[model samples]
Target chain A: MLDSERLATDSKPNILLKGTKEGLLLLLNEVVSFESLLEDLSTLIHGEKKSLFEGPDLKISVDYGERVFAASEIREILDCLAKRENLILREWGPSTAAKLSLFNSSRKFGPQTLLKGTVRAGQRPVFEGDVVVIGDVNPGAEIVASGDIYVLGRLRGIAHAGFLGDWSAIIAAAEFAPMQLRIADIVSRAPERDGKPLRTFMEFAYLKEDSMAVDKLDSLHAWTAMARQSS
Target chain B: MGTAIVVTSGKGGVGKTTSTANIGTALALLGKSVCLLDADIGLRNLDVVLGLENRIIYDIIDVISKDCKLEQALIRDKRFEHLTLLPAAQTKDKSILSPETVKELVGALKELHDFVIIDCPAGIELGFQMAVSGADRAIVVTTPETPAVRDADRVIGLLEKEGIRNPHLVVNRIRPQMVKRGEMLDIDEIVQVLAIDLLGIVPDDETIIKNANKGEPTVMKPDSKASLAYRNIARRILGESVPLLSFEEAPGFWGKMKKVFGAK
Candidate 1:
């Protein structure tokens, strides 16, 4: 085993390894050069300290403190960790105040489809990926998407997002008076009033736990925090 | 060279036949030769509404089957010199008429008339298809009710799918008093939901029922509100820009007193 104090003081190590309740946590220093960090990580995993990661099915999470890695650099780090057969890469991301962008991240969305006309009544537009409608969706129309749904106009019809059961998907519109909204497996209907005043600002609907919750577009921080914690 | 306009409403009793009779009469009154074709075969009522039921010796089925010439089956309107009526068969089912046969008949009629107005039957079945197959334009008639507007939306979607783009809308039987009290949908609301151009708006009036019962279209009675509305719609169809009729009701005695006291 390696001495933690000695490694911290000697040569100012760029990588630190700690055991957590979930599994192993690797914290990478942002100041060090990328090449040196990769070198140190490889040396630590393949050298004399390899016994720490030798356990069966140990999950490892990498937290890059205030550092953003390019796609190729992340691939290089993944290749270095792939050397250990028992270690599984669980989660890897930047841990900083800028993490609020996790909600706007495009990684979870599938291919997007752009529809340019109004979805009139009796029209059902189904897509395998995300769907973006540039016009109004009438009362009897329906839209089904496997990922997120974005409507630039009034959404007066039925919208089903995460059709294949992706719970994190969301439905958003400029005028959010939908006849019915479905996110993942949960469904919500409009209130029982014929004259519910139309909303002026943009609104969005998302799944909280087991039910659907609606909120204004300005309060996106709550969505970011919820998404980060759920994932 | 003539334009064929099909009047359609997916749901029943939204005044498809009444609109056809009145609009055709209004157009003929404007000095344009017009032909009214009733496509509701088993439920034929355009002739009765137009007061030409007694003059129909041969029906559209006779014309399609070559049992009679198209001119022989066409009944000249007793009131308007330029108006003609081709009544539907009383006993024949709507499924007997194919799209191709209706297209050929409309093509022949177009050669001799300035405008051919088709009265489409309720429901989006073969009758509706046959009526719309020969039209160059479409006028979707809908009331302000939700079911009627929903059905109109569905029919407009089908029309657009069949390559009839930008169909006009005519809101029929709107009561101005209910609309003023917010108890009924206004014209703007209906137009916004349907997302189509407004052709005209007909208010609900007792004169329309009386005129229909007398076998005279409401357009022939110039004193009624619906008659003026139909005239405006016909003028608009003739490429004239006519402002929409004001649906505001006259102020009551209390309202006039309040207005006199400078109350808004």
Candidate 2:
């Protein structure tokens, strides 16, 4: 838990502005609408623009709660922060306690099935726990796992991770060339390749903002929560 | 006891029958006793390909139904002294050959021959099941096309499930010129995609058509590239280390020298 010091006291303040050694910390209330929060943040910054700060340079750390932010939402926040002259948004993340709770939420329930051959066409392997395959999942094959799916080879088939609706479940592969990917209830289709081969060492798909998001292991920093906990 | 090897492809028109007849003939040519069994039942074609159709007085159904002795149904190939074929019944359905009957027939063939090569029908149906029922190993025949490769992958999966591990692959009808032009899948691409041990790559040659029409396998034409490829496949199946033939019959040395000198 951060030492959240409330700098403003509205009747029901959804945006908390706090003073830190580095910069101002903006702790957003998870229950409030993002539009209202952003509007409130803007009003507070400009309302006391003359007396609140001394220099033109400003640094901020936006702390989100249990809500998983989307890429668009993060971009929105960054855009809002750039509105201030000479501003640098240092970090944005969920509370440490929320992250810990998320880790504990998706626990291993049963033994994982480890397969060493290609899952071919017209074949589907449905497993209750983690499913790991050391071979390619060819097109027309479907693999459904209640937990995570780690394909050590090319994945050109359909993969459904957390099929029973566990949002924390992930699906990863060496070559992320799936026809379709699903994490929990969120589904994503593979983007049309531009006739150029993508050199993906390892990529994982997870639920982000009620949608399936795929990120390469190289660009792992974008997925702060997952990058923190090695899977 | 002889080893029963089933030549199969999940999709049709991928040269399963051609591979069977050629490889079986090649094995017999290598001084090994081989028995080729056509397990396609009503769609029988191995006998026609082997030119043994005119002498088919008793068929496999006659042997299975105890209407004739097993040796009575065997037809000796005229080209090879050690080669024999137990032809499939052209009129019967695939359901007549149960898994048990296939196993028993393969066992009986094993007692008399060094190699029993079964030509499995296309598609993973009852005919395919009966073909691979008693096999100790398998050879998956596939073309460079997407449908053939996809079905071959499925058949490989089924073979593994049946405890047939590491089935070899033969990519047939590969055109070196088309592969060079990047229009067709190469042998390496097919092997990589299927992730199986490659037995051989048979180049697309007109000799195959000629041999088939003449009721002789391409392996009979020793100078043909497809025949040499089949012989290499047979050698590999016999636990011999035979290097893969380079299907890169591109423009010859004279053409390369001409290009180097900028000669017309």
Interface RMSD after interface superposition, each candidate:
0.7, 1.1
Clashes of each: 0, 0
Tens digits of lDDT, candidate 2, B1-264: 988999999999989999999999999989999999989888889998988889899988989988999998999999887899999887754456798899899999999999999999888977788888999999999999988998998999899888899899999998888988988976776887788899888999999988898899989889989999999998988889988888665678998999999998
lDDT of 1 at B57: 94
TM-score of the second chain, each candidate in turn, equals: 0.96, 0.95
lDDT against the true structure, per candidate, is: 0.89, 0.84
- Write the residue-wise lDDT of candidate 1 on A1-231 in tens digits: 447875677565688776654677788888878998898899889987888888799888888978878899999999999988889877787762223333345455668999988898999989878889999899999999999899999999999999999888889999988999998889999877657678768999998878999999877667966696557
At residue A195, candidate 2 shows an lDDT of 62
The per-residue C-alpha lDDT of model 1 at residue A45 equals 91
Cα displacement (angstroms), candidate 2, residue A13, comes to: 44
